[model samples]
Target chain A: MSGGKLITGFAVTATSHTLGEYRARGGYQALERALLGMKPEEVTGEITASGLQGRGGAAFPVGRKWSVIRPDDGETHYLCANADEGEPGTFKDRWVLENAPHLLLEAMLIASYALGVRHSFVYIRGEFDLAYRRLAGAVEEAYGAGLFGKDIFGSGFSCDVFVVRGAGSYVCGEASALITSIEGKKGYPRNRPPRLTVRGLYQKPTVINNVETLANIPWIIAHGAQAYRTFGTTKSPGTRLVSVSGHVTRPGVYEVEHGYPVGRFIHEDCGGVLGGRALKAVIPGGISTKVLTASEIEPHRLGHFGDCEDRRVLPQSAGIPHLEPLVFEGESLQAAGSSLGSGGMIVIAEGTCMVRVLQVMLRFYHHESCGQCTPCREGMGWLHRIVDRIVSGRGRPEDVDRLYEISRANDGTTICGLGDAAGYATVGILDKFRCEFEYFIAHGRSRYDGCLECLGSS
Target chain B: MKHLIPECEALKARLPQGFESTLVLPCLRRVQEERGYVADGDIDALAQYLGVPRVQIEEVLSFYTQFRRQPIGRWHLQACHNVSCSLRGAGSLLDRLRERLGIEPGQTTPDGRFTLSTVECLGSCGTAPVLVVNEVYHESMTPEKLDALLEGLE
Candidate 1:
């Protein structure tokens, strides 16, 4: 609550909130400065010192990504803004595009200048027409203002941002997959080492930054590294836009410092769960990560882990949202065994059948599987079918072990994180809530005792 | 409308030759944006300008949900039918629109005032149960809002 204005620095102004409004409010001022006065390395150094990390789920350091791009090597270096915000329950980036398009545009211009790239693309999801339109409109506005096209702000540095629409693939959110999509290919993720920064977007050095991460850059440049660092923990440094959803009374986006407590985010910011229902479980990051129960939530106060010694604490990337009227925690969620993915906290209220909930999620992962990887495609379908059988009251005891086996084999075999996501969800639910699963298998009913009629329908 | 048509023609002239696939969809999108739907002659003219086979252009246009193959009403109503929208009562909203429009999905009303269509996703999931009338997004849609929205169009 008490922090310098890093992420939400320009969010409050009413008129300049739109692209035209942003230009009037000195929105692309940083890009002009970067192009006119500073060298690429100087801009990169400022970002490195600012401690900005990729906000597109991975949380990779932005400066480090820029450092990897060698402008002197001089192939066509690409700068991609990862706008494929497909993570379940996360919509903060969409809000940024809708409200502050020029911020992201300015950030990209600065980033492209630092990377010495002329051709940059923002690979936005196809579903985000509004964002696409806003970005396109912003680009035109910037061009007309002579703030984006050649010799921007009277400097020799030149860069152009093109918006490419993605065909609704979640995997494309990954940097490699995003590059592939921009290259007019199927959006499958590529292996690293020959990473995107080294060989991306037509085999050139490309720096891919998330929308929120790029939006933070203009502020970082304007306010200086120390000013940016004043907000969050030393390692994390700066505010983040957390998209809190689920059973909470006021489920919406909140701009909080990096190290803000999860409990405050949930109880104070999100207005707690509706009807005073007990918090059953929380999928911290996105649904991809494992679930954390109440006991786990109670002890693990959210903070940044900057040093190697700090690794003992919880990783800062795990999105923190407090679940009130604590229902499940500790060994229960760990027993469920899912990681907190993209801070897409879905607080399952009490009385909702656990098996049914898992089934719905399983069906989603199953349907969304791109089918390129055998383990993920086949294994997800297998788990979904088994969960479906169980939910429909025809589950066999062997189905539990089968789910575990399929999930284990699926974990590391696939090309992308989608495999791990499916594996984690399946194994986490079974491991953390084995008794509930067993009760369903034996009695052909939910152990929660409130949803008998809901069960009867299945 | 005439001013918009000349603008469309200029945009069509800018399409690169032999790269018909890329320009076709964008041209169709432009025409739809201006006129509310892509008329057949417009598609034919677009095909001629881009130097692509009309069938190829038509196929690509038909593939994307955003491309309207037939002439619709003065206003276009696209309801979001993706997972988030589905969870937030987009189905009920669509049902209400269909009842109010007196036309089923993909059909324009008899008065040529509106056309109803269900789209994959509109990407405003936070404000779920959303719909787009022309280019403007209407969020947190209800039956009452739908009625008011239709009335406003009139």
Candidate 2:
């Protein structure tokens, strides 16, 4: 709440998602202001200055992705909103879709004007019923109100939005695969040299952006980039929608500023670990980003960790030079050897089996692997089988090393980032809790008495 | 198939030009909605109707998990067994249901009322241990709640 709400400024009501409610909240004004007043390059210039990072997972700069297109280049441009929110433990986009759909639409309209897009698309996963309905409804309303079509607000800029729904394929969440999916093909990621902006979506210049990243455009265009910079840390301009789940008492979506401390965000904002349990580890971002142990997050809580001899209590190695300084930003987290990838924080409480947790993560990677690349297709299965063997009480001492070897094989071996993502998750957990894997292998069962679920529930 | 000529033409008209293949997924979904599963004849007919290759339709059908080839039971139970749900007894929840139905994940019950399956993350981790029966989500599930849901189902 401290960073200041932009898209979610209005409270949720029965009529909140309606176009009338959105117009009352001053929606589409950004489009009016942009079309009637500014040139295409000027809008893109403002976005580049805002430093808005991609909210999908990879913190790629949005403006940099947009800057590649020239509106007057005589080539038809396509702007796509990647609403395939399939990342595990990430549902923040669903919030925007269900509540502030018009914000995304208005933002898309402004983006279309900036990019010279005549036809745009929104590719959302099929699992989302309510979210899809709301977005489709918003699109219909806009078209009916003359917001879409040949001329809008007498600006002569013609744009139309098509809502393309995807079947249940996680790989389609990838940019090239999303385009391929929209093209009515198997969702296979294309090798880059064409880089989407060059040749994409029926072999034309296309710009695919994450849902949350595009939602910030209206805010940036409404107020200048300089004013947007006044919100969060200069390095990470504006707030992030963090979807916290797992052992947190209040497991929901939260709008956190960039520089907000992870410790305070978890302990105070999320109401701490459920059942007053001590925090064990935090998977900062999706399952792909590296896992941060409890002490690594709050290095100042040395007193809380108590014993210096305990292997998990050492936060000094987290690379924090000052006290209470670890905050939720891209630069700082990257410096600490992790990232805020997708802002899907899965909080773990004490008394949970870290080995079992890794097993779950590996299983996801295995199941969701697109099978397009050899390394991901086979290596994911290898890792999943090894973890399954370890969890099933037949794990060998060499199995841990085998897991690492398979993880190494998976790194950079795939067409998309899925292979590397699996490797990072496997290594991140093994690096932090090698002892748990060893114990589970040696004892043929989990040493910890509990799982990722709450113990109070029967 | 003969009766569906107008429906196919209307659907083809609604989609974009030169992208006739894009209608493969939507055609499969529409057929599946009407018939529970997309039969081989349906695929062949859709290929002829949409002017796309049969292999293209087949690949798209097999590539996505949503486009099923087999007939599903009345209650298609898909339980999420990912990290958040795994933490919140998703495995146990599946185990209980599996035991009650006496079938594996891909198997249908003898009564033809239930087919249990494990799914990846449904993106509702806040309410862990989620179960979806015929496209409707049942979250924060308990043993009693699951049993009652089965009882209430026709």
Give Cα-based local distance difference scores for all models. Answer: 0.68, 0.85
> In candidate 1, residue A313 scores what lDDT?
42
Candidate with best lDDT: 2
Q: For model 1, what is the error of residue B153's alpha carbon versus the real structure, in angstroms, after optimal superposition?
A: 9.5
Worst 10 residues of 1 chain A by lDDT: A449-458
Candidate 1's residue-wise lDDT over B1-154, tens digit each? 2334565454334222232344444455567667767787886777666566777666545443455656778788888664445445566788888777788877878888887776643455556668888768898777888888888897
Across A158-250, the per-residue lDDT of candidate 1 in tens digits comes to 766666676456677878877766654455678777877778777778888888989899988887888888877776777777666555567
- Give me the displacement of residue A448 in model 2, in angstroms: 0.8
Best by DockQ: 2
What are the candidates' individual DockQ scores?
A: 0.16, 0.66
The segments of candidate 1 whose C-alpha lies over 4 angstroms from its true place after superposition are: A10-14, A300-343, A447-458, B1-125, B129-138, B141-154
Model 2 residue A417 CA deviation in Å: 0.6
CAPRI-style docking class of model 2 based on DockQ: medium
| Predictions: Cα RMSD each | 7.4, 2.3
Residue pair clashes in candidate 2: A452-B87, A453-B87
Q: Best by TM-score, which number? A: 2
TM-score versus the correct structure, for each prediction? 0.77, 0.95
